[model samples]
Target chain A: SQQGEEDPQALSIQEGENATMNCSYKTSINNLQWYRQNSGRGLVHLILIRSNEREKHSGRLRVTLDTSKKSSSLLITASRAADTASYFCATVWNNDMRFGAGTRLTVKP
Target chain B: GAGVSQSPSNKVTEKGKDVELRCDPISGHTALYWYRQRLGQGLEFLIYFQGNSAPDKSGLPSDRFSAERTGESVSTLTIQRTQQEDSAVYLCASSLTSGSFSYEQYFGPGTRLTVT
Candidate 1:
């Protein structure tokens, strides 16, 4: 069963713009992690925010977690053409990790 | 030094046939996971293994699906009597450890399986 559900199933934006994706889960999670997948193959880990942490940043990627609402968001600043891919949010509960359906982002160069 | 690796990048099998997919996790990583992703769909967890503990197979869809791991090394997912609905990309991942909420999972390139 999938634990997280992402909003805005698809988004298109021009290069240099920013893209925001949101995810909501049903149960309490130990942490939330975001991943990026290109060509529908391997997924690359982007960032992980623990439940205790409100926000985290890595490079141009910013992740915000709200445990009270059981939601999280990922913001990609200055999006590049290469950033066109599928982004997924996974909720981790103990040893089990469930991923959302994902939001497909297209950045036109 | 090498990340997780999966074999037979692509496989095409006829319906009702059995297929096997392999995964070699990163060295020294004690946690491994398997997931299936349908066309344009999110990943569905299949199984998980941690160190010497029993594998958590709760996510497996049916009895036709099974997997085995040798200690903390290579793992294989076997699907018996495959159906067209079984067609999907099988992904494998490994982490430093599980039962803890800190480590990030490293994924493999994934094996694309097609059931004809």
Candidate 2:
């Protein structure tokens, strides 16, 4: 069973715009981490937010977590063509990590 | 500093045949994990190894699927009597340590396994 499900399976945006992807999970989690994967490559760690944290920022990325809602959102500010890839949200619970289906983002320059 | 590395970027084997995949984690990382991703699907946890302690094999799909780690370094995943349904991209990841917080995982390029 999948613990996390991401919204908007795919999104297309223009360069310089902000792209937002949301994820929701079924159970409580210790933390949530976001990862990006380019075509035919390994996944790159983006950011991690603990259950106690409501928001976090790293470079152009902003992540928000709502424990009560069992949801999280990742925002990429000033998106670029280089940001075109698949983004995934994974949850850590009881020493186990599970990934969501992911959102495919395309940035048009 | 070398990142996690996996051998045989792609593999193809006939049904009922066996296959082996390998992973070499970062020099000093202590935690390693295996995951499987099917076409257009999310990653599924397969197994985890933390140091010399017993590995967490709860996520393995079947008895035919087994993994071994040597001295907290190289690890190999073996699939016996493979089936077509076992085809997928197998990914290996390693982290400095294991816990729910503060540890970041580095991933390998992954092995695309095709069981015909």
Candidate 3:
């Protein structure tokens, strides 16, 4: 079974606009990581936020995690057409990890 | 250096036939994972192999599915008596270690399997 569930099954935005996606999980997690998939294939690791940390940033990506709420959000700033892809949240517990359904984002140039 | 690799970028098989998907994880990595994603759906965890410990097969949907890995090198996922509902993209990933949940996984270009 999937642990996390991403909201806003789809989103559309213009270039340079910021895009935000939220994910909610069911149980406790050791860490939460976000990934981006292009053409529904390989997934590229984006940012990882541990349960101890609340927020993290990598380049243009910002991630925030709230263990109490069992939720996390990924914010991409100054989005570009290249940023258009399916974003997923994976919650890891112990040695196991489960991914969400993913939010399909489209950045119009 | 090369990343995780999976063979047969795409495969179409007839129902009731058997198909095998292969994965070659990055060298020195001690953790391997397999997942299945149906069209327009979330990825479903299949199984994982962490170093020498026994593989975790709890996520496998049925007994028709099985996976094997030798040490930390290569892995294969085999599905017997394939069904149409089994069509999905199979993804493989590897991490430096599964002992830590903080390690990011490196993914391979998934193999798309279509059972007709």
Candidate 4:
């Protein structure tokens, strides 16, 4: 079963704009991770934010975690056409992991 | 240094036929996971294997779905009496260990299964 739901099921933006996606989950988590998947392809790990860490950044991707609200947000800065894909948020507790439906992002070049 | 790999990238079989999908985890990786993804849907966890421990098969949708792992090297997911609802992209991943730390999972291209 899925653990949470992602907000803004889909988004469309022009190149060079920023895209933000949110995830809300239930139960406590050891960490939260973001993944990107192109159409008909496997998932690519983007960033992981530990429960103790409120924010993390890698390249143009920034992830923020809020344990109190059981929610997290992923931000893609200076979005490119290549950034167009489905982004998922997965919550991990112990050895079990759960992923939400994800947000489909489209960047018009 | 090779990443996770799965064989028979695509499979098409009739209903009631059994099919087996294979996954070879990255060398020395002790954690292997299987997930099913339907079109435009999120991944559905199927099973997990960590080292020599018993696998977690809680996510399996039915009794007909079973999997086996040889030591920590290779794993196969078998669906007995396959149904059309079982058609989906079966993905395999492996992490360095089963620890709940910062370990990230590496995934294969996935096996696309079609039950006609």
Measured by TM-score, the strongest candidate is 1
User: Candidate 2, residues A1-109: lDDT per residue as tens digits?
Assistant: 4678898899999999999999999999999999998884689999999999999999999999999999999999999999999999988886667788899999999
Candidate 2 chain B, poorest ten consecutive residues by summed lDDT: B96-105
Candidate 2 docks at the CAPRI level of medium
Per lDDT, the best of the predicted structures is: 1
- True-vs-predicted CA distance for residue B19, candidate 1, Å: 0.6
| TM accuracy, model 1 | 0.97
Off by over 4 Å in 4: none
TM-score of chain B of 1: 0.97
| Deviation from native of the Cα of residue A23 in model 2, angstroms | 1.1
TM-score of each: 0.97, 0.94, 0.97, 0.97
Candidate 1 residue-wise lDDT at A7? 85
Candidate 3 lDDT over A1-109, as tens digits, reads 8889999899999999999999999888889999999998999999888889999999999999988888999999999999999999999888888899999999999
Model 2 residue B106 distance off true place after TM-score fit, in angstroms: 0.4
Candidate 1 residue lDDT tens string, B1-116:
79999998999999999999999999999989999999998899999998899999999999999999999999999999999999999999998864567768899999999999
Query: Relative to the unseen true structure, what is the C-alpha lDDT of residue A100 in candidate 1, on a scale of 0 to 100?
Result: 90
Instruction: Report per-candidate TM-score of chain A alone.
Output: 0.98, 0.98, 0.98, 0.98
- CA-based DockQ, model 3: 0.80
Alpha-carbon deviation at B42 in model 3, angstroms: 1.5
lDDT of 1 by residue, A1-109 (tens): 8889998899999999999999999998888999999998999999999989999999999999988898999999999999999999998888778889999999999
Instruction: In candidate 3, list every pair of residues with a backbone clash.
Output: none
